[model samples]
Target: MASNRPAPEAPFIPAQRETETFGYGDHRTDEGPWEEWNPTEDSVRPVRGRHRVAKQRGGLARSSTVLGVGVIAAVGAGGMASAHTGKPPVSLSMPDLPSVGSLFDDSSASDAARATTPTLSKVGVTSADSDRSGNAGEALRNRIMAQAEQQQSKADSKATAAALADAEKQSAAAAAKAQKEAAAKAAAAKEKAEAAAKKKAEEERLAALAKEYKLPVVSYTITGTFGQPGSMWSSGYHTGLDFAAPTGTLIKAIHSGTITQAGWAGAYGYRTVLTLDDGTELWFCHQSSIGVSVGQKVSTGDVIGRVGATGNVTGPHLHLEVHPNGQATGIDPAPWLRDKGLNP
Candidate 1:
């Protein structure tokens, strides 16, 4: 290392006197006026103000002190350079005596040489600072990338969750729809089964009634149904079921009944009324002749009268009417006969 302390000044030495004169011999005249003398600071004449030594150029005066300091700095810097560069330090030596002109030369040459030299410590500091800067930049980039990835992951998770929710909703709706359709089908099937059961029960009842009743006339064609509308009838509608047959078709009792009346009616000629055990009156009109008398009890299938086309009639047919409980107003006889197992 170089010290910052100032360099020591060089010692002053007086110029040496010539021992012998140039043209004179070694011996001197004893009687001459010359004397033996030595030069001293006070004895020499001083230069005047304008005659003083001029100041040197290029930063500092040319002197042994400045030269010494520059040499010390150069040696220290060279040694450090050698250590860092893996090279051997160059040896530097000083001469025992040097020329005065060499020591007093311009200092500009030395400054230019020092300025061009490179220092190991300065380069090392710069390299270390650059490494630190690069590392900091890399760290910042990594943090930014991590944040971006986190955000993307969150977005993907949200999208997936939304899709799953939608799918669940659709699935639930489909399940509900299927359940409703199945329930509807079950109800319709139940209704159809109930209707079939009702029809079966009705057929069974009719079958049982068929064994207890008989039709009034055999081999007869139904010509007019009850409630047939026409101008020919006085009531504006036919009041009885008309059975067309030959003039002498035999009429039989529909059920076990008593003959209540056997006489001629105005519009229904030769009408015969048979009263059942329940007071239901059955009238057999347009009869050619009455076979059973009033107040006579007859069983089913017993002969009652003969079918004929009588009063207010255009053909040979038997008109049958029914009155519940002997009411004067008659009801349609077709359904009444069906109740007794007869499809008239």
Candidate 2:
């Protein structure tokens, strides 16, 4: 009957099918005749004898695991970026796929680039620790150099001090030697001057003695010499030398002379006088006998009289007197005899 009822609906049944994904050699099952086939639980399966399960109720477990991993990676990247001062990361995803974190890359380096980084020691300084290490090494080097310089300076100073001391020593020695030589020279010169003065004095004395008159006294025993002090004389000293002898001793002329007087005089008894060529006079008193008379010439060794007791005498003596220029003056008989190379 073309009844007004709607066309009958086909009987409905769900095919026994399992959704799956394929990877590598894994694929879905395609078996039996496709035209007449009805899919049954026994008819369909994975080709690798595997089929997808419910995917843990819409794959929530896997999705949760992936989401957790991404969150951790993003946190790590954010922390690194904070320290590095680089750009922020972005998330990339394929169509109908889960997203993944893509971190920013350093611009200075590429995927193929390699770097040769320097060590902190060679880089001189970077962090606080490296800066301290570098500074310590530099300070040590500078101290070593300074110590070396100081040692060298000290050595130089010592050498200069030694040189100065040596120079001073040499100069002192030279000056001492010069002074010694000068002293020796002065001594020699003084000795030479003294010798010359003595020689001149001796020559003058000899000349005066040669120009003097000869002795006038005759041979007699000399009792008193010239320059003898006498209390009986009017002068302080005796002017004539006294000769005490026997009354008969020969009286000889002391030098070449001429008889001046032979007579008795007051205070001079029995006197014989002689005169020299230089006007010198010799008196021989107390003569026992007068051999030569007045105005008689006599040589130096001629007999003039004999010894006798003269005036103002205690015994027989020939009083011999010498006078320069017959002036009633007398000189020393010792010196007069020494001038003729004879000792009185």
Candidate 3:
């Protein structure tokens, strides 16, 4: 098919140089005809490398081939530097090299070489795994600390509870002890008060009893005592006390009693017998005149008769006798009368 685009030109191929030349200026070949040097515009092609413009028709082809070979060599050297080092090509400083600017200007080739090279990270840098491990260790440490705190708190609470319980127990015991002491003290005081009151009541009763009792006689002269040896009675002794007094002298009863007999006896004269509440009898013999009748009640110091020589007496005198339980025998009335707060 017919197209509008231009056809590609053919590549130039160079023939080998037969002999080598080593001089700077032009020289003649060994067999070709001599040609004169010309400086006219039409004769001189641009001098490049080892090739020259020839007069024959194929001269352009030979020079083009040499140029192509030089270009291919430069491109290969630039590619190798870029591929191995991933940088600009080595340039001429002390050693000769291609220009660094020209090599770096190929941005697309530099990028391709960089992509093919193995990538590396900086040395001695941190990573995600190490960070995670550090975080886990810190968390574990915090958990351990928290658990220790909880255990310490529990121990403190137990100690406090035990101390409180002991305090309460001690307080209760102290309270009970105080109460018991108070009760004991109160009981002792009450007992002491009762004893004092009982003693006071006894004193009052004894004082009242002392006020009620009296002596038997006021003023009496004892002439003869009981159990005295005298020739005054048939028993050959004085059986009773003799109160010597004038005739018609008032004679009083010894104590409160009932008059059981008040009449004349056989041997002498009138006699009066008084019986007390406890069955004791008092005989007032030798009374001249009897003032009380039989079956009469009399008090202490009441007039019962008058003193007279009525019984077997020497003169006008009163003979007093006492009998316990109204028996025939008699005791001395002196001590009996003194027992009731009397000295006589």
Candidate 4:
């Protein structure tokens, strides 16, 4: 019926159908009136177009992964730059495809330049540290020297004290010795003075005694002694000492005494007797003349009589006799007079 309308277009379909993709192989085995199907030149045109489209999609996905890794490296480089410059991290971004080569190349050149350059310190203190160390050493030396000086001073002080003590001891000993010597000298001088005083006293006593006593007669010759035998007396021995002298020789009294008898006796003619305070009687027999009276007091060296041969005598002489207690017997008058401090 020759419809006057345009024909409908065919719906588009993919060249690789779903059924064809799921099948295991492209070759089929069936008894049919068909030859082995081979790819035609016209049929290969669609397959080439599909392969090109797949290659484009795969390349776009791999490029996106590479861009993400590049963005991470850019962020790390920015953090490192912030640390070195002491600033905040710069905002990081993925570089445009056209500018990636130029941006990464410039960042590498800056890192190499930083590695070559040397850093400098702004506030310098090297000289100050050196000076401080030297001062510390000097201080230590000074302290050591001070300690040594203190020890030496202590030793010197001890030595001085010892020397002073020794000197004091010596001085004390010397003083003691001097005192002892002085005492000895004083004692010797006192002893000498005592001896001199004793000698002087003895001389004074002797001088006084010499003035108190005297001898009985000046000079006389002894002829007949007491106890002489030769028919000289009636008693068969001479009874007294005979002082032979010239007639009228002065006869002195021997000591202070009283006259008891002044008369002539029988054999002793013109005799005189003198009695002392102690009752001793001195008889003067053979006297030429008698001058003292009876009961008369006479002193020593006084004239008592004159020497002569008046009694029964041979020649002129003075016969002296000593009788204790006025007894008839008598002792030698020479020793009796000598006992009274008279050497006669």
Number of the top-ranking candidate, with lDDT as the measure: 1
- Model 3: per-residue lDDT, tens digit, 1-344? 44233322333444454363322133333212222233454345344344444333223333334334544554565466457546554321111112212223347865665455322221111254347547867988999999999999999999999999999999999999999999999999999999999878866765554454444334567888888996657888878777777788888877788999989996547999999999999888888888999899998778888888865667887777879999998888776655544445
RMSD per model, one decimal: 17.3, 22.7, 27.1, 29.3
**How high is the CA lDDT of each candidate model?**
0.73, 0.62, 0.65, 0.66
User: Backbone clashes in each candidate structure, one number apiece?
Assistant: 0, 0, 0, 0
lDDT of 1 by residue, 1-344 (tens): 44233322333344344565322345333212222234355434343432333232221333444445645766676577567555556444322222222344457754554455443233223344457558867988999999999999999999999999999999999999999999999999999999999888888888877766899987989999888999998889988889999999999998888999998998898999999999999999998999989899999889999999877899899999999999988998888888777887
TM-score of each: 0.55, 0.40, 0.39, 0.40
The segments of candidate 2 whose C-alpha lies over 4 angstroms from its true place after superposition are 1-220
lDDT tens digits, residue span 1-344, model 4: 33222222223332333344111244222111122223344433443222221222223333444445655655566566557646555444321133222222347764665454332221122354446547867887999999999999999999999999999999999999999999988888888888888877756754553354344345688899889987758999999888888888888887788999998887887898989888999888888999999999998778888887886989988888999999989998777765554556
Q: How many clashes (backbone atoms < 3 Å, residues ≥3 apart in a chain or on different chains) does model 1 have?
A: 0
Q: What is the clash count of model 2? A: 0
Q: Arrange candidates by TM-score, highest first: which order?
A: 1, 2, 4, 3
Q: How far is candidate 2 from the true structure (C-alpha RMSD, Å)?
A: 22.7
Over 264-300, each residue of candidate 2 has an lDDT whose tens digit, in order, gives 8756678988898889888888787889989999887
* Candidate 3, pairs of clashing residues: none
Relative to the true structure, candidate 4 has a C-alpha RMSD (angstroms) of: 29.3
